[model samples]
Target: MPNHDQLPTDEERDMLRGSVRGFLGQHIAGARTVDAGRQTERQLWKQLANLGLTALGTDPGQGGLREVVIVQEELGRAGCGSPLLSAALLNLSGVVEQANDERVAAVLAGMHTGDHCIPLAFGEFDGDRSAGRPALRSDRLTGDIAFVEGAEGATHFAVFTAGPVLTIVDADAPGVMIEAATAMHLGGQSRVRFADAPTVRVPLNKDGVDNLVAIARLGYAARAYGAARRAFELAVAYAKERKQFGQAIGRFQAIQHKLANCHIDLQGVELTIGSAAKQYDAGARDWHWFAAAACVLAGDALRQVSLETHHTFGAIGYSEEHEAPRHFKRIHLDVLRHGGARPARDELADRFLGGTPDRLPEYDLGPAANEFRGEVRAWLLEHWSGERRAAHQQPPFAEREYDRAFALDLGRTGWIGLAWRKHFGGQERSAFEQLALMEEMERAEAPRAGAPVQAAMLQVYGTPEQRRKYLPEILNGKAIYGMGYSEPDSGSDLASLRTRAVRDGDHYVINGQKIWTTTYWGEYMLLAARTNPDSKPAHAGISMFIVPMDTPGITIQTSTTMYGGTFANVFYDNVKVPAANMVGDEGNGWKVLTGALATERGFIGGGIVLKVAHAFELLCTYLRGVETDGKPMRLDPIVRQKIGDLAARIESGRQMMLYCAKQVDSGETPPHDAAASKVYSGELMERFGEVALDILGLEATLTEGSPGAILRGRIEQNLRHSLMWVISIGTNEIQRSIIAQRGLGLPR
Candidate 1:
C-alpha cells in the first residue's frame, strides 16, 4: 500500500473505475432506500466481495488503498449505503498486514466473505475525530463514543484511544448500547455508550496510528471528490437543458462563471487528492500533513461545489425527492465527520508554521530536477540579497535594470534555456527542470527572463537559420522580443488582423499598427501579418516575420498601464523585412502562433502561481509579527482562516502548473490544460490581492521607502498588477471558451 509506483497501470486503473461504476449504476443509482437504520444491501455486498474489493488492501498482489479510493469514489457517486469504508478499509485494511495475529487473521479472512461486520468507534462526544482519548481499566472499556460509522450493523467494534491504542469489543457485550444517529449521507451512524464493556487490547504503534488516520482522511477525501463530481455533472447537465428567457441557462455568463469556478475547485481537489494519495502510498513521512491538507482542501471545495450545484438546480434540488440534495447533505456529513475543514486547516497551519526552521514541502520533481533546483536555489541565495529584492520590486510591466543584470548573470551561467540543446548554449534538461528553475526565480522575487517567446518557439518549429540567427542572442541575454500579433481591432480575434505583409522585390513590406505590445523595449518583434487575403479561412493566410524594432518607418509610442508597467503602440508603415525573416511557411503563421502560445501560457501560468506563493509568504510573515487588537495578527481566527485559504489555493495552482509542464514535456499540445492553469492562476492572483489588502487595510497602500511598508509596498503593486493577468495573453473569457470547447468538448 505504500508504493504508488507499484500500483496498477493507467489502463488497469481505468478498467477498475469502469467496472465499479457499472456495478454501482446497476444497484445504487436510484432513489435512496427508505430504511431508517441498520439496513444493509446484503446482495450488493456479496457482489462487491465477489469483485475482490473487500480484500483490496490485504496484500500487494491483490490491490491497495489506491484501489480502495477508486471504489469509494464510485460508491459515493452512486449514493450507495454500504459499510465498505468502515469495515473494509478502516478495519480490514488496518490489520491485514498483521495477519499473523489470530484475531487479525480471523477478521481479515471473514471480512472478505462479508461474514464479519466490524465498524470503527474511534471518536467520543461531539464526534470530533481528533477529540477522543480513552484508557483501559480492569479488562474493560468505558467511554461514550459518538459517530461510529455503521455501528448499527456491526457484530464487533474496533475502538481507538489517544494512547493511540486499539481495543476490540463484541457489540453484544454487557453494558454496551447503540443509539441510532442521523447522518447526512446514505448510511446511518450510532452513538455507542460502553460502561465496562469487555475488551481485548490490540497492538498499534504511533506510526500505525499515523497510517490509520492518514488512510481514513484520504478515504473521506476520495469520497468527497466523487460526490462533488456527481454534483458538478448534474449542474452542467441542468444548465444545458434548463431554459430561462428563451435560452438555456448555461449560455449566461453569470451561470458560466459560477460553474467555471466550481470546475476550477473540483479540478484542484482532484490533483491535490492524487498528490496526497501518491505521497501516502509511498509512505513518505510528510503524508501525515498532506493527508490533512487534502482533507481540508477537499472539504472546502466540496462545500462550495455542492452549494453552487444545488443552486443551479433551483427548487427541485432543494426537495428531498431529488438526488442533488442527498449529495449536498452527504458533503456536509463527510466533511464534518473528520473534524471538519476548520480543525483540519488549523492542523495544516500548525504543521507549516510551527515546524522546524526551513521545514518546507518537497517539489517531488525527481532527482535531476531537484538537483537543478538546488543549484538555482544556491545561486539565488548567494546573489539575491535583500537590496536586490527591493530593487527588483518594480511593477511587472516596467523595465528595471536590476532584472537585466540578474538575467545576464544567469545567461553567463548557461542557465537560460536550460532545457534547450547544449549546442545552442542550453544544458538540455527536462521541461520539469526548467519549470523548477522558473518557480525558484519567482519564489526568490528575482527578475524573470524577458520575452522567451521566440526562443521557445524556435526550439520547436524554427528553421536552422532562425535558430542560429536568434537563439544564441537570446541565450546570451542580448535579444529581447516583443509580440506584434494584437492589432487595435483584432485582439483575441487575431486571425482577422488587418496587418498586411506584401511581397516586394526580394523583400516583404509590412504595414500594421500593433497596440499593447508588452516588453516593447525588445530588440526584435515577431510580427504577424496577412500574407494571403484570398485564403478561405482568414487565419490560414496569416504569416509571421522577425522584424528589427528600429526598422525604418517603424514607430514605438510607450503607454503606461494602471499596474505601472509600460507597453507600446508599434506602427509599421511600409516597413520592409528581408524575405528570409519569415518563420515557417508563408501562410502558416496561425500554426506557429498557436504553438508558441501553448508554451507562453505555461510560463505565464507557472509564474503567477509562484508569485502568489511568494506574496502569501510575505503576508504571513507580516501577520505573525504585526499586532491587531493588541495581539499578533496571526492570533485572529479570521486572519488565520484567510491564511489557510490562501495556502490551499497556492498549493493547488502550483500543482496545476506542474501538470501543465508535464503535459508539455510529454509532447502533447494540451491547449486546454494550459488554459485551465492560466485562468485559475490569474483569478487566484486577484483573490490574493483582495484578501491581503483586506488584512492590511490602509497600511497596505504604502509604497517603496515608506516607513513600515509591507514587503516594500509590493502588496499594493500586486493589487494593481492582478487584473492585467486576466486581460492579457488572451482574456480569461477567451480561455474559458477554449476550456469549454477543447477540454470539455462542448460546442463553440
Candidate 2:
C-alpha cells in the first residue's frame, strides 16, 4: 500500500492537480452559476473529458479514486459546477460494472467521450420521503426519484431499483418525465417520474452497489473539503491584507486563533478523504468504514469552517456575490447528498457499538511499521497482561502510570532506544518503528518507559565521558531525568528564568528554584541557569547542566495535583555541579533546551490523543452493554451520534500524529507541525472528557473507588487529567501562537 502519511509528492499527481487547477482558473470566472445553461455545462464536460478526468478509475494506468478526488477538489475550489461526480464517476461506475453488456458498453463509450450525460438516480432524498426509489416489475420501472444531479441535458439515466438491480433508461423514453427541482445549491438537480418505462438491465450485484455508494460518498466529501479549503484560503488572505486598528487583523490573537483552527479542521477533512481513497485503491476491506468516516467528518467540519470563513470576512462575505458564499453553498449541498452524515454516523456507530472488533479504523503505517505494531502488541500481551497488569494496577492511580521494574524489563528488550543511533547503544530503528512502539504501549496502558529526550540530548551534545555515564543508565532504564527549566515566574517564557550558576574552581554553584517539576523524584535534573547575567539577550547567557538530584543544598517540596499526581517545587541553594556535567558550550543552552523540548512536545501530542482514543473505547464498551430506562444506551440516537463524532475526530487526530511522525522521519525538526499536533490533540483530549461526562451523566463524575462509578471512574479522572495536558508542555494558547506565526506565517 502507498504511504498515505506523507503528502502527495508524485510528479504525475502534482501535474494532474496543477493542470486541473489551471483549467479552472482560466475557464471559470467569479463565483460559479448554475444558470450557465446546458450547452455551456456540456462544453465544460467535454473539456474535462479531454483532460482524462472522466476516464479516471476506468483504467488502472489512468488513475483511480485518488485521481477522481483531486479533480473533485479542484472543481469545489473554483466553485465551478461539473458533471464529474454524478456522470463521470457515479454513472460511469455502474456502466463499467456491466461492461460485458453491449448496451452498457455503448453508454460507457458515450460517457467517456462526453457525448452522453448519464446521471445515476439511486436511493431516496436525504430526510425527505416525497420521492422514493423506483420499482422494477417485468423489466419496467415505475416510481419517482428525487434530487438526480447532472440530470440536465442527459441522454440516459442509470436508475437503481428496490430489486437491487441497476437499469439504464433513455431520458426521452415514453412515460418518463423529468422536471427541474429547486435545490439547496446550483447543481442541476431534477425529479424524474417513470410510469412503466422500459429499462435495460446493467447486471450490477449487491457488492457492486456497495462499492458505487462508497465511492459516491467519498466523491461528495472530497468536493466539500475542497470548497472548505478554498474558503479558508480566501479568509487567510483577507486577514493578511485587510487592515484594522492600524495593523493587519491577522496580528490579533483572536483572528489568528480562528484561522489556526480552520487550518487544523481543513487538515482533518483533507487527510480523512485521502486516507479513504488510498485505502480503496489498495483494495482494503475496511475502505467502506473509512469512507463513512470521511463523509461524517467532512460534513461536520465543512459546515463549521464555512461559517467561520464568513465570520472572518464579515459583512462583505455575507453578500451572495462574494466568492465565499458560493463555496458555502457548495459545501453544504454536496455533503448533504448521499444520505448526509446521519446514515454514515449510524454505520460507524454499528461498528463501534457492535461486538465486532470494537475500535476505530486502523491506519496503514507502512509494512515494516505495521509488522512492528503487531509484534509490540503481542509483546505487551505477554508481559503486561493478566496477573502482572492486575498487580500493577493495584497501586494508587498516579503511581501506576510508571513502574521501575516494568521499565527495566522493557528496556532489556532493546526497544527503549529504538530510534536512537547505533553508536549510542540503540538499535537505530526508523521513526515509523518508534511510532509503532509508542502506539502499542499507549494502547496497552503500559507504564511509561525510556528517557528518550535525555538520551537524545546526550547523544547530540554530551561529552564522551558524559555519554559513557548517562547513555547506558538511560538505555537500561536505570535513570530518569527531571526538567528544571520552568521557575515560578518563567513558565512558557523560559528566557526570563532567573536561575543563576556561578563558576567556582571546577564546579558551577547553582542557586534558584523550579516549580511544577513533575519528575522531581527522578535521579537527575536537566538544569538550565544563567552563566552571564549581563549578556546582550537574557537567553544568550543561559547554560545547561545535568545536576544530580542528591546534590547537597537542594530541597524539594511536594504537593498533590488536582488529579492526584504529585509534583514538586525544587529549590537549589548553592548546589554544586561538576563542570564536566555541563552539556554543550556555555551561553548556547537555548538551542539544547529547545531541541529536547521539541521532541517532548511531539510525543506529548501523540500521547494525549492515544489516551483519548483508549478512553473513548472504554466508553463505547460501557454503552454497548449498559441500559438506560429499559433501553440500551447504544440504541440512543443522541448517544450514537456523539460517539460517532468523537470516533471521527479521534481518527483525524491519529492522522495528524502520523503526519508529524513522517516529518520527524524526514530528519526535520518540524516545530510548527509538532505544535499543531500538540495543540489539536491536547484540546481534543479536553473535548473528549467533557463530551464523555455529558453522554454518561452524573455517575460518570464519581470517583474511582465509588460504587456504581462508570469505567471505574476513569472518565472523571481523565477529565481532570486532561487539564494538565493543555496547560503543561507549553500551554495550548502558546502552541496556537506557534501555529499562527510559524505554520501560517501570520504576524505575531
On lDDT, the candidate that comes out on top is 2
Q: Tens digit of lDDT per residue, candidate 1, span 1-748?
A: 4456666776887899999999888767567642344445455556777887777766554556667788878877877656677654554345665545687667656668876667665543223744344556866888777666666666677777656556777888897898776666444656788889987666666666656655676777788778889988888888888888988887776677677778878888888777776676666767666666677788788899999988888897977788888788777777776566676677666643443322336678989999889999999998886777665654443655236777777778777778777776688888789878887887776766645678877876678998898998888776788889898999999989999999998899998899999767778999899999999788999998999988898998988888777778999999999998988888999999988888789767888888887887767766666787797676677776777777777778888888887877787747877888899999999999999888888989987567987887789889888998988889998888777556654434
Q: How high a TM-score does candidate 2 get? A: 0.95
**Worst 10-residue lDDT window, candidate 1:** 351-360
What clash count does candidate 1 reach?
2
lDDT of 2 at 654: 83
TM of each candidate vs. truth: 0.90, 0.95
After aligning candidate 1 to the native by TM-score, how far in Å is the CA of 261 from where it should be?
2.7
Each prediction's Cα lDDT score?
Answer: 0.76, 0.83
User: How many pairs collide in each candidate, listed in order?
Assistant: 2, 0
Candidate 2: give the clashing pairs: none
Off by over 4 Å in 1: 1-12, 33-39, 58-61, 88-105, 125-144, 185-187, 193-196, 203-211, 237-256, 311-322, 355-360, 382-397, 421-426, 532-536
Candidate 2 RMSD to the real structure: 2.6
